[model samples]
Target: MIKIADITNIEERKAIENIIRNYREDSGTVISLLQDIQGHYNYLPAYILQLLSRELKIPLSKIYSVATFYAQFSFNEKGKHIITVCDGTACHVKGGPLLYDYLINQLGIHGGETTPDKIFSIEIVRCLGCCAISPVMIVDDELYGNLNMQKISKILSKIRKEEMIQEGSK
Candidate 1:
């Protein structure tokens, strides 16, 4: 077994330890603890979940269920850029599927798969509630609307360039 001494981040370790201590006896608090961990790390790592489960004596299945059920929680390692395509009725009627396919084909990965370089993760959402902007996509929270095939290509190119620039700066 790996020793806790390997955990170097004192604050982070304390935060997690505190959560576990405060909610040790509360089974329902597992979800909240997971959320707090997610706030620290963009996505929940399986090992961390297992650690919490062991500490709290919660079943792994129950932890997995909550993670899968919540839309806010992500099991996949997220990319620097998150691409969300809206496919609600309004968006769907306006060729959302076509746009989604274009993105997947171009990225060479389906929704939830991060690129090999971990620069992007494609996501499909039922709606953004912006029916007016049917066939829309959001890149890192910036919404683009009224998309056509050509427009999508351009937008993707722009995203790639932006990612490249960010990487170069770092």
Candidate 2:
């Protein structure tokens, strides 16, 4: 719920502004701008996207395509915790599907869907490059190996507790 103008990171904001200013009429540059925005916000804030469209004179549809086409781009506000399950060839053969189902059912959301309370979003990745930990899942960049449904619940509760503490502090 923060305004992009409220962003305190001057350099990051400048990079986005520069990209838009340099390529106001170029659709190609729109893709790059969206990428940069996503990198800054974890998810592209809707207001910023509108700002870019108006400033760049690009159609909103085009901007949406660029945002949705890339797996990295997320339109919805991402949760404080991002849970990514790896389902590459190695992980798939090693019970990845079950883990995926577990996450979906437990979180009450499908892959790419944020939780109702916005505490977590579950994402499925093709590979995490850790075959040794075939059924590996990452929660906020922290990798967990040899996961089971029980462990997922434990980790989620721990994360929710931590988020609550952080929210209280703010």
Candidate 3:
């Protein structure tokens, strides 16, 4: 039997083991277990999912079926930083689509596409629940509301510069 360490790093393997330990008694918690895994890894890695399938005695087909049913779950790897642009009705009225277009042009990436350097990812969501803060851009956990293209440019530029500094130091 292939061990989890054969597919993932020691830290990742440990995380998977811990997650399994939490759900081992209840086989019905597959969704919860997968959700926890996604939280740690950002996206659902194929190998990790296969490892999960074997660990839980669940068929790969069934695991994939559940994973496919949820749009929030992703199989592709995500960038270190996530940039979400809201395009809901309120945000749209406030130029959400225009902002999204600007970002797509500036970053050379659209929804679901990460930058080549894996520094940033751009995503479009229907709503962000803050109508007053319409036309919002979220970078990781920080939110910037009522954003103009200029503000967006500055924000991204600052992040890029910071990343460059860190890379140089490394």
Clashes of each: 0, 0, 0
Which tens-of-lDDT digit does each residue in 140-162 have in candidate 3? 99999989999999998999999
TM-score of each model, in listed order: 0.71, 0.68, 0.80
Error (Å) of candidate 1 at residue 36 is 3.3
Error of 3 at 53 (Å): 0.9
Better of 1 and 2 by TM-score: 1
**Residue 33 error, candidate 3, Å:** 1.6
Candidate number with greatest lDDT:
3
Q: In angstroms, how far off is 155's CA in candidate 3?
A: 2.2
Error of 2 at 39 (Å): 4.4
Candidate 2 lDDT (Cα, 0 to 1): 0.81
Local accuracy by lDDT, each model: 0.82, 0.81, 0.85
Candidate 1 residues 35-140, lDDT tens each? 8778777689887788777777789899999899998998878887789888799999999998888889998989878898887888888889888968888988
Model 3 — which ten-residue stretch has the worst lDDT? Answer: 1-10
